[model samples]
Target: MNQQLIAFLAYLSPSLFVITALTSWYQAGLRPTAVKKLGMISSFFGILSSLILAYAVYQQDLIEISTFSIYGLGLSLRLDTVSMLMFSMIAILSFVIMRYSLNYLDGDHRQGTFLGRLAATIVSVQFLVLSGNLAVLLASWILTSLCLHRLLVFYKKRPGAIIAAKKKSIVARLADISLLIGFVLLYQIFGTGNLEIIFQNVREGISPLLATATIFIALAALLKSAQFPTHGWLLEVMETPTPVSSLLHAGLLNAGPFLIIRLAFIMEATSTASTLLIILGAFTAIYGSVVYLTQTSIKTALGYSSIAHMGFSLMVCGLGVYPAAMLHLIAHSFYKAHSFLSSGSVIDLIRAAKVTGAKRIGNPFKIILGILLAIAMYSSFAYLWGVDIQNEFQLFVIGGIIVLGLSRLFSFALDSNASIKLWFQALVLSAVVALAFFSLESIFHFFLMGNVPELTIPSLSEVILMSTVLTLFGLVVFIQIFSPILNQKSSFQALAVHIRNGLYINVVFDRIVRAHYHKEDSNSRIVLEEAEIGKYILDSKENNNEEQEERLA
Candidate 1:
């Protein structure tokens, strides 16, 4: 319960990860089983330390520790509610994923190297979230990218992995420069690099330089989160390893929204930055979601899903709903981790379930009716949850999106049967969604009371933004309800191909990157083939054959 004890506990987990990572590399003579046991032990201690820190922070509002200083910058850590939540997530996921790798990479020649690097990456991200100074935060951010690049190129002979890592490095360098500029501008304006001082200055009033700094930070977040143009690397990196994909998609990609949330106060002051975040994030969300529907590769689909999720998170931050963004971050992390780790079983799972005949396509009028019903359900649930109908236009629109999705899902369920049991199930499902919405909102309101400024009313621009997003999602609902009818047309099929090809966006980038960086015969490094599902299926078949040979021998 003491502040000093909390600080010690806060430092313990990352230190344990770093020490274990170093030992894994140096103690290479140990058997694989012994090395795995060491990893398990280190992970357990890390989780335990994180649990202690979480408890301490829950009891105390916030805890700050300044251990030392280099130059004029203080080496400090701030354990607030948000940072505590992020720390716990990193500790838990690292433990689970490392355990998964024990079997996932059982017989690899460089298993030890992979484990060490994974631990090192985890440590860097943990430090980044907990850092109390801008200098330390920036250094940790860059360190995380470097470690991820190494993991991306773990199979050095694989040309695809090499290309993906190279492209990712370029994007990350751009992000790093943006973040550095933002930090310098902040220090110049506030006359201090300390986060506390900067936040105090932001609270007093926004200076002219603050808005420019916030825009730089927003740009850095967009790049880091793989917004539109920078998302090619994310889709291509699936060649590295499953565990690596799990870590990158589920853990590292979250740093972008985390950065935005960390500076929400400054961002709220700048309407230009907020509007930019809203527009860009909304566009990315729509683009990624559509492309995801077209992709055949499971990892590539998941990559697009990550992009969409991150965009939506940024949009929530732009709307002044910081707590909701945090909730989105934590939920998406766990969901994507499970999705990636279980990706290999997808084919088996699908084969086990037999599909019945498809439902008859609904007419346009019926689909329109479904939309209106969804709006009604959303309104009822929002009222029950005490959502202010007069204000919070963004929240109302978001609730409508969720309800619309649920309606599409239930449309199929209700089409088959008119039974009371099915109807009861649908009602319960809607209630669960409503309950979750309010529960997360309540927790966020309690923990992040003053940190994130409240939105009083929606501006005209915000209203337009809200309408555009709702219309986009509404179109998606309409398409889902009547897909069987639309797919029969030729134009629809042609559009499907383009969407599946990611509208040839990455193709343009591929040529530009190769022309600039690749002097040798780069004929084989075409990025279009990178996201094909067949590539992974072939790789799996080869691995299976090798395992069969080993067993026979």
Candidate 2:
């Protein structure tokens, strides 16, 4: 693959999407059906371009294309392993979501307009990943959010959708501001916005200006990822179209960790920003994991799941495990896209699920045994694999987190009725999964070798923060095991209510919003009500047909 050809193929994707957007807008009213075909074509083209870009970059580490220069920043497309990987993932996911949308918006009006906006949004993200300059990155970041805002509020009649969009808009602007200011600060300090040059400066020293900018960037990532307490909008966005939800969750929400990795050198330079990421990411992960279990609605449950996963990704980034975060983000995007697209099937599964009455608590002895076994398994595997806990603390702690999660499996295996074979099988399964995780971690780290550096030596406080993450997840496992007993207590019940309502975090945002955009939204569930009404009508027709058959007989 020639560098010039790779560049052309990379540019072809966004160019195709730009054409699709324009065609959709112009022909939406006249030939609505054609809009989808055009969007899918553009998306599939993007996937092809991504694969070619990946192979070309593998041969020659990086392919840089400087289109032009403006305001101290070069408008360039930089294709490396990280960028190429993200490109392929985003392109493939967008294509799948677009295909799903063909049936999703079957009879919607102005379908062309929606597909156009969606295509435009996909292109914005595509450009962002390929960006080689801070200026281009910031521009693409803002544009991505702006384009998605329309999709979030696609159901204008649904007040829930409107409110979610409003909340997200407010947060998005704050994120943009923090990111822009971070760039401005970096530009003032380094006198250039070329990311490579700035990265070099970052290695020289961690000055006050650099640290400040890094903290601001961290704040922006937190907001973009919808970290705890400010995550209500993410959960309440269920009123929007399913495709919109999938795109936002699976594609857009990953921008936070991606932003961290893009500026990996700066994040590695400043311990303050890294600490901030660790604290917030740990809290958000724990909060999301715990609260999601109590959610009755599928979208909100998935919403919490995204939050938890994002937090974990950020945590990995803050720990200087950039490759691990990348892997986590890519895997989560696929799972979340599938989760949102097949949400109807999930609902059916839940309906068909049988609930057992009078749950009994697992034996405390068994729980303790499970925890010990999980820890021993992880420790032994890490040692056997030559994972130096003292040196490579990042890999060690992340691997530990996965094993703690496996504690649940161990607990189940330790059931009183379980045979010795079951316990042995559980241990073997744990080893296989643990080995796979370590294998993937090493593979991504190898691919990202020089590009994403690890902190090798851990500071005392940093080590404690990572320890806290492991502790937090361990507590979650314990809670799950004893939930049957805890559910009976009033205090636990009250806490569940608060968690279910997202601890009233969004209420503050709502109050702020109502002060400016007050409205009578008491009965603003138009979309859901319409769905129910349609179902009712269909059921009535079925009943009438059955009666007619009986009369004719």
Candidate 3:
């Protein structure tokens, strides 16, 4: 295989997708059959070309194809391990999504336009991932945001869709501004915008401006990944078509963690920025997870779960475990995409099954046994893998959490089983989960061998932060285990109401944003039903009182 040909194929793949999409939108706008065929053909070429390129890159080590230059910076595309992985993922996922939309929007008039925008979005992300320079990366990032915004407002008449797009636009622009600032700072310090040069400089020595630039980069990532107050946009964007939601949650939203990993060397040099990432990421993780459990709408619940996953990914990057973050990114993308696409069947499944209430079964002995198994399993694996526990305590903690979750799963399965064969099956399932996780991590670690820097001994502050995170993880698990018992008490219902309302955070932000900027059509049917938090709380209390009166009668 010629290396040049391989590189050309890689570029040609996404180019084909873009060209076909534009042609379909422009020429076959009214012909659904023609549009669908073109989409399928384009995606087929994309997957084939990406796979070929990935194989070539793996055989050839790394390839940088420079096309042009401005001042000292080159407009270039690189095919390294990280870029190859991302390119392949984009190709495969786009193919799946495009195939799905053929049936999903079979008769929709604007199906051609939807497919075009979807292809454009994927192409933009591919460019962002393949970028070898800061200038190219920033341009690709902006393009991706614009393409996704068009997909988000597929139904222009829906007020919720419009408002969500508006909110997302505001946050994306803020993120862009932060990224621009970081770029300027890096150029000023390193004297070039080339990523290779910048990274090399980072390895050789730290710059005085690196800390400030890294902080700006982290800020951009936080906004892009929908952290905290800015996350309302993600939840509200559910009015878009299901395929669009799948792409947004699973693909585009991962840019934050990817950006952080791309600059791992810089992050490793700046402890302050890393610490800030830890704090912000930890808070968002816990916040999103809590809200996820309270949602009734399946899509909205999935949105919160995406937030939690992204937050946890960012936290992993902060821990200097960039390989683990990459694995998380890839795994979450596939899982969330499938989850969103198949979410329509959830109601059917639930209606067909028995409505079992949460059981009050808290066995202390089992819990203790599970915790011990987790410790033993993870510790043994770490030892076998020769992981440096003295410096990488964060990895150990994460491994323990993973194993602990699996242990609980096995315990639940065993508790319900009556036969010895069933118990054996549960243990086998637990082992399989552990083995799969380790296998995936090992592959990513191999690809990322040189990317991550060796960590020094943990500082006192980092130790305290890690301890805090462990405590929070334990707290979340404890709540999950015991919340059913507390739910039966009258006093806990108020707390439940607040939790279900997302603690009124999004409600307050929604009102302020809409009051200031939203200009909705008077006759639009889309209403902000969840915006009136106070009314909801009051109504819940009145309903409770009525239920009590009826019971007394």
Candidate 4:
């Protein structure tokens, strides 16, 4: 990939998406087939370009398209390893989602409008990832949220959709303001908004101003990622079409982690921001994972699952393991998109059986066996990779989490006779999984070696935070595996109620939204209904009067 070719592809890629969006919006008269065809063509080209860029564009292949060069203080689009990685992920997922929508929304009235908004959302995300200018990045951030809001309210008549969209808008605006504050602080600290300049200027001993900016930036990431207290909107947004849900869960929600990764220099430099991310991100992960198990709806459960995944990703970032966090996100996006799109098939498969609520009666001995095996497997991989607790504590802790989660699979091995063969088979499977996991981790780390910060030993506080998070994750796993026994307890049942309601945070949000916006919605509907009734009465009276006069004559 030469410079001219790389530049051409970069320009062509974004142009394709933008052109498709404008044409779709222009032909918003429900020309579903044409819109679908256009979307496919553009996405195909986009995927190709992005894939090429991902492979060819490296750390030094920095390309910038500046709007204007006025004292080196203008907005520009950037193309580097980070941006290229994001470009590849989003482009590939966008293609999958658009292709799915063509069939999912066949012959729908507003399909064109939905596809148009979807394309626009894609465009916003592309610019956001490619932005070298922090100002342009923030603007793209705002645009992404606005476009997604429009998609959320595609079914305008649904009250749930309207309310969800409203809450999302409110939260998104606050996040935007928080990020804007951070951006202003950055300009003050470095005297420039150009990201390359800022990165070049950042040092180990950052100033008070830069540290303060990290807190605000971290806050914005939390809000944008749909962390707890504001995560209800994500669960309640099932009123949109499935394709919309797929994109929202898979791509758009990743903006938060992406933001943190983009500002890794500052974020990892400050203990305050890192602590905030670890504590809250880990808490939300637990909260969401618990709530996810309690939900009856598949989509709602998946929504909560996304919350958990994003929380964990941010937590990993907080640990200063940027490569692992990035890998987690990319893998999760693919898994979640597939999970959502195939959700209906789950119902179909189970509908044939007259099934009741089945419980997992776990064997304590087996669970313990699985845990030991998981630990051994993780240790084996860690040793092979030359990763130790002293130097790469972050990866070590992350591997612990992975193995802990993997232990749950042992509960489903289905061997009632306590056979050795089953245990051997499970052990083999764990090794394979561990091998694949470390291989991908190594690749991502290679690509991101110079792009992100190097791993360092944690402080006491950071060590405690990691231990607490690990304990919480272990507790979650225990509860899941022992639910049959745990459910029998009164205290367990009580906790379930609270967790199911999201600890009532969303209830407070609902009250606030209803108090402010419910009246306008009700008044307009009432007024329209009253006008229709009045017109009907007037027509009836005129007909009656004419009939009586004709009879008299």
Best by TM-score: 2
In model 4, which residue pairs have backbone atoms overlapping below 3 Å? none
Assess candidate 4 and give its TM-score to the true structure.
0.89
Error of 3 at 315 (Å): 0.4
Q: Using alpha carbons, what is the TM-score of model 3?
A: 0.89
TM-score of each model, in listed order = 0.91, 0.91, 0.89, 0.89
lDDT at position 531, candidate 3? 50
Residue 441's lDDT within candidate 2 is: 81
Q: Model 2 over residues 162-245: C-alpha lDDT tens digits?
A: 878888988899999999999999999988888877888788866689889999999999999999767778977888789888
What's the lDDT of the predicted structure labeled candidate 1? 0.81
Q: Positional deviation of 220 in candidate 3, in angstroms?
A: 1.0
Name model 1 segments beyond 4 Å from true: 27-30, 70-72, 414-427, 515-553
Residue-wise C-alpha lDDT for candidate 1, range 255-319, written one tens digit per residue? 99999888777788788888778878878888898899888888899999999998888888777
Consecutive 10-residue window with the lowest summed lDDT within model 4: 409-418
- lDDT (C-alpha) at residue 220 in model 1: 93
lDDT tens digits, residue span 1-553, model 3 = 7757876786886787688667766744555666577778878888888778778877777777788889657678877888878778888888999999888977788888888888789889989999888888999989989999999889886668988898899889999999999989999998887887788888899888999999999999999999987888998888889899999988999999989988788788889888878888988988898888888888889999999899999988888878888999999999999999999888789879997632335565665565566567666777877777677787776776676576665455433424667557656777777777777787888887765665567788898898888788777766665554667788888877887777888777778667235355543422344355557899999999999999999
Candidate 3 stretches with Cα past 4 Å from truth are 1-3, 355-358, 410-426, 454-456, 515-553
Better of 1 and 4 by lDDT: 4
Candidate 1, residue 522: the lDDT equals 50
Ranking by lDDT: 2, 4, 1, 3
